[model samples]
Each structure stands twice: as structure tokens, then as C-alpha cells.
Target: MTKLTGRLDDDRRTLVLTRQFDVPAEQLWTDFTDPDRLERWFGAWTGDPASGQVMLTMNAEAESVPAVPCRILHCDRPRRLSVTVTDSFGTWQLAIGFDEDEGSTRLTLRHEEVDLQTVPEVGPGWEWYLDRLTAAVAGEAPPTLEDFVDTYAPMGQDYAVMISGS
Candidate 1:
């Protein structure tokens, strides 16, 4: 299970999730920034990142999926990455931070300026994705979507109550 926290930043709501791995920061950074490595877990991206934009395909769902346009907002190599992703659903302001301590790396993912109404779906979605990354890094099979729906779906109520401050 993952622990997600909600807070306000600059009057905007933010949801954060963190995971710790017994891996070096450099390796974790590569897993995030390297296109090939990213494909193993999340999705593949085309176009040069230096150009500030890329078309990302979420290949985990369908073999032939439309690519989404992602604009890089802030990038600090091996440390932080911030981007705005526009897809069919909506625009997502996402950021990931990597911190290494005592030979372990802690990955923090922040979904910023999010609508409180979407917390139920958005929170578990990230938990599933991060678990996928964890599996990829461990060289294990990724969790099936069915597994996520069965296990993490109910946690949405918890997230709702949390963000609602009730």
C-alpha cells in the first residue's frame, strides 16, 4: 500500500506520493529521464527533450495509442523534473524529485494544482504507476490493471475523505 498526502501550495491543492528504493540516485534518475528506461515502466517519449517538448505514448494500455503532448517546465538533472501533460482527460502539472540517502533513493511525485474532485481517481492512478516503476526496477512483472482496480480502487474513498479534510 502507498501513503499519499495532500496539501496546499500557493492556494493550489497538491497531492504527493513517495517511495523508497534500495538503489542509487543515479540509477533511479536514469529510470526516469532515459527514454528507453522509461519505456520499460511508464511510456515512451519522442522528440528531443532539449527542445522542451515531447510526444509521449502511454503504451501500457494499447499497442497503438495516440501520443500526448508534454511540455517540459522545469528540469534539474538527476534531481527534479516538472512537466505539463495534456491528454484527452485534461492537463496535468506533474513533478518528480529524487533524493538519495544512505545508498537508497527516495522518489517523490507531486501532482500540482489538481482539482479536488479528481482526487479519488488521480490518487490511485499514481500509486499504480509508481508500483509499476517499482516492478520494472526490480525486473519483475508489472501489476495488472485488474489487480489495481481490485486492490487500490477502494482506497479512493480514503483519499476522498482525506482531501475533503473529513
Candidate 2:
């Protein structure tokens, strides 16, 4: 499997994560927008994610985190999705772009309007989630949250330093 890394853009106040998947854009789109497929890697959402507001329960084990309310900003199938998510912390703007190549897809996830201080925490979490997505696409078991945290925690510091230096 290919390793994925996220780039923190201080000027734009966005955390950009890019990954190349061996699957087609349609498959990648389903993995991202379908509730059943999303639950495999990210979270399960209720309500209409395609048009209106939805409540997302992070992890199938709802006890892990409270449900977050998110408003769908834009939903262009197999191409782009933008949403504003509100949780205990605050509201966040997220946009995902998918570009299809010959037999693969390039996915770029941008977390816009991010706080510089939280990059350390947020960046690694996204990395772990993306890795889980990769595993899901490959029909492999996703890593547990604890395992992901333990393995990627150190990379958070590296993200912090990179963000601080830039």
C-alpha cells in the first residue's frame, strides 16, 4: 500500500490531505458519500447527506463520540463534496475533491478554516482515518482507534513542527 501524508497550509488556513486510490472515482465516491460504506472507515450518518443536514455518529460504537451535526454545502457526485460540520469544539468547513485518472482516482480533502494550534491533533486523526479508508477499499480490517493513536501520535509532533516552521 502507498503511504499518504497531509499538508498543512498556514496561509490558507487549510489542512490538505491527498491520496491516490487504485479504484475508480465512482467507487471512491461511494466510499465517501454512502452511509454504509462510510461507516466502514469514517462514521455513519443519519438524515439526508446528499441534500440537507445530517447527524454523524463517529465510529459505529456511538459511545466513542457524540453525534455531530453537519450541513451539506455542496454535493457534486463523483467530483466534489463540501460541508460545514458543527460539534462540541466549533464549526469546520470541509471540502473533498476527486479527480479520476485512467484507472485510478486522486482524492484531496481540504479542511478549511482550521486553527493553527490544533494542527497537531487534527492532522494525525485525518491521516489515521484516511488509512482506514485505504484498508476498507482493499477489503482489509481497519485499525482500532487506540492502535492508530499510539502509532501516529509521534507524527503529530512532526506536523506541529512543520506547521510552526512554515
Candidate 3:
């Protein structure tokens, strides 16, 4: 498994997360865009994945949150995707960029226009979910939310401090 870390770009109000996968860019893109494939890792989504609104029900065993409504902003197959997500907390933008090197794929997930105060929670959540994606891609069972949260909770403090410069 690869180390999960995110770069905080205060100036841009973005949290940039990166991951390198042994699979091709197209495979990674399918994991994200195809609802069936997405359900294997990330939340299950309904509606047109290419363009338009979608509803996502996050798959979790404990502390499950409500389904979020998202609007697809851009979709350039196997390359880039942008969406606006809205939930009880608020609305935010998420962008994913994929680059292929040889047969491997590098994914850059950017959470844009974010409220820095939420870093402690959001950072760890993304880390766990992304790791689940990695596991799914590797044909392994996804970890339960309890396990993921327990393992990643401590890292939230590190991310908070990094983003706060304190």
C-alpha cells in the first residue's frame, strides 16, 4: 500500500491528494465514472455519470452520513473530472486529474474552494476512501469504516496542523 498524504495549498484553498496506481489511466477513470465500479470502492451513485446531477450514498458501516447531491461540472474521459458536491455541511468543488506513465496511472484529486476549518475531518475521510479505492482496484475487500476511521483519525491532527501552520 502507498503512503497517503495530501498537500495543503492555502493560497489556492485546495487540498491536493495524489496516488499512483499500477493500473492504466482508463481503468482508474472507469473506477470513478462507472457507477458499478465506483460502488466497489467509493459511494454508490445514481443518475447520468457523464453529465448532470447524481446522488451518492456512501457505503459505511458506522457513522454513516446522508446521501450527497452532486453536479458534474466537467468530464474528460480518462483524464479529468470536476464536480460540485452539496451536503448538510455545505457545497464544495472536487476535481480529479489522471496522468498515465507507461502502464501506470497517477491520480491527482483536488478539493477546491474549501473551508480550512474542515481539514481535520475531510482530510482523514478522503484518505480512508482513497485507500478503499486502491484496495478495490487491487481486487481486495474494502476496509470497514470503523477500521478506516480508527486508523486514520490520528492523521487528521497532522493535517490540521499542516493546514493551520501552527
> Please, what is the TM-score per model?
0.90, 0.91, 0.91
Model 3, span 92-136: residue lDDT tens: 899999999999999999999878888888888788888889889
Error of 1 at 17 (Å): 0.4
lDDT of each: 0.84, 0.84, 0.84
Candidate 2 lDDT tens digits, 7-110: 86657599999889988999998998789999999998898754689998888332688888989999898899999999988998999999999979999999
lDDT of 1 at 40: 88
In Å, residue 123's CA in model 1 sits off its true spot by 0.3
Q: State each model's C-alpha RMSD to the native.
A: 2.2, 2.4, 2.1
**Regions of candidate 2 where Cα sits further than 4 Å from its true position:** 1-4, 60-63
Give lDDT: candidate 1, residue 67.
94
Candidate 3, superposed: residue stretches over 4 Å from native:
1-4, 10-12, 61-64
lDDT of 1 by residue, 40-67 (tens): 8888999999999999998666357799
What's model 2's overall lDDT?
Answer: 0.84
